[model samples]
Target: MSNRSRPDSAGSPRGSDEAAQGPGVSAGTAPVGTVLVVLHQARSTPGRIGARLQRRGYGLDVRRPALGEDLPQTLDGHCGVVVFGGPMSANDPHPFLREETVLLERALARSVPTLGVCLGAQLMARALGARVDGHREGVCEIGYYPLEATPAGAALLPWPDHVYHWHSEGFDLPEGAELLATGRTFPHQAFRYGMNGYGLQFHPEVTREMMAAWTERGAHRLTHPGAQPAEAHFSGFDRHDGAVCRWLDAFLDAWLAAAPLK
Candidate 1:
């Protein structure tokens, strides 16, 4: 798969070459701390989230533990952690998954700023001793769906009416975790474990190009019981993407502000 186009801070399309460079230090300034980005696939990039972090002046230290890349034993020198979603389940017996869960556990223990998306969210829930499993009816959420912010979530920030989803499984809200957002099929859309840790089941990081690629390559997923038609995905993007992007910007700001770099 080709590297998906991402938007720069100015909202212009950035080429794959530029995106491939990842986040780096600006010309003369000493670096703001780095955020450890954990991705599951070889070709996977952090998409909008990485770009947002770069614009905020934090360098990205991208790691793919699935491909034998080793994660740091600690979050030393790291300001935050973002674990992106993937095809693998958090319940899988893969050693890398176990390693990541352990790392997430440690990060939470240290009160490190952490954001988990989709499978990443599931991993966070697992680390907190919550169960991650498929729906009893076997329904999946493969496209855009309605999202309602709970009273607790609305107090933090406004949310988009609908958000993109692509998962067969959902996680139970772990003990002590606050449910931030909700959906029909997957009730637990977003949650906060502590002041610094967040888990979102939807993909606010998805860009238009990423959506196109996902729909094409994973077309079969649309046939699932609760999945949306491929065309609806594009329509949903046109109608809801602006709100989602705004929400992401606000959320990232709040997330970083929640914990000062240690």
Candidate 2:
């Protein structure tokens, strides 16, 4: 019943004291002890999440922990972790997938507060042993859609109740994991496991350009046999950039105030 794939990365390994110990890291301008952003693939950057944290005077660390990347070990040095989206499926036969999930598991164990988007979210679910698979119909939903956060999701609010969408696979809420939101197509739009960790099926951090960037790479998914692109009425992202940032800040503060890992 241990909810994790890689137990080794249980929590932030290098404490806040050691956060400044690393050499030649990408070194995002975020202050020391800000937050860690885990990139699943090159495409899935932190998006608005990183922008928000930087403005808040909090340091941001980007790492591909799945690729066995280095530095800023452990949750003690970070305010939180954000896992960005990716084209990869959670079930892919990649050892790095397992390793990434284990890191997420460790974050959960220490209540370090982690956020996973799309594949990032799926991996969170997978690490916790929930179901993660592609759409049988292969109906990969690109573009925007509304997400109705459940009561649980509201608890973590400033949530919009109805938000954006961008994934094909969905998950049944894992045991003790709160189903925070639901999309029309994907029942498991978002969830909160325990108190701090979050798994979101949607992409709240994406900008209009980022969305376009996504479409450029995965454009095939738009016309993928029978897939649906963002509707003509779908508009685009603009306002949510600030909103998601504020929400992320609150999430970090709440997690930190409740669990002091200094």
Candidate 1 regions exceeding 4 Å error are 1-24
Report model 1's TM-score to 2 decimal places: 0.91
Poorest lDDT segment (10 consecutive residues) of candidate 1: 1-10
Per-residue lDDT of model 2, residues 1-262, tens digit only = 0112111211212312112223322455435456787765433446555665555455667887555675354567676777766555688777777777777888888788688877788889988889887656656555556667577667766565445555667777787788877876667877888777778777666555555555555555566533445442144445344565466567656655555423
TM-score of the candidate numbered 2? 0.75
Q: Write the per-residue lDDT of candidate 1 for residues 1-262, one digit (tens) a residue.
A: 1111111111113454224245556778765778999987756778888888877778889899988999998788798999988887788889999999999999999899999999899999999999998889988888899999999999999999999888888899999999999999889999998899999999888888777767777776678788888899999999999999999999999898889653
Q: Given candidate 1, what's the lDDT at residue 136?
A: 90
Q: Model-by-model lDDT, in order?
A: 0.83, 0.61
Give candidate 1's error at residue 88 in angstroms. Answer: 0.8
Determine which window of 10 residues in candidate 2 has minimal summed lDDT. Answer: 1-10
Cα misplacement distance, residue 47 of candidate 2 (Å): 1.1
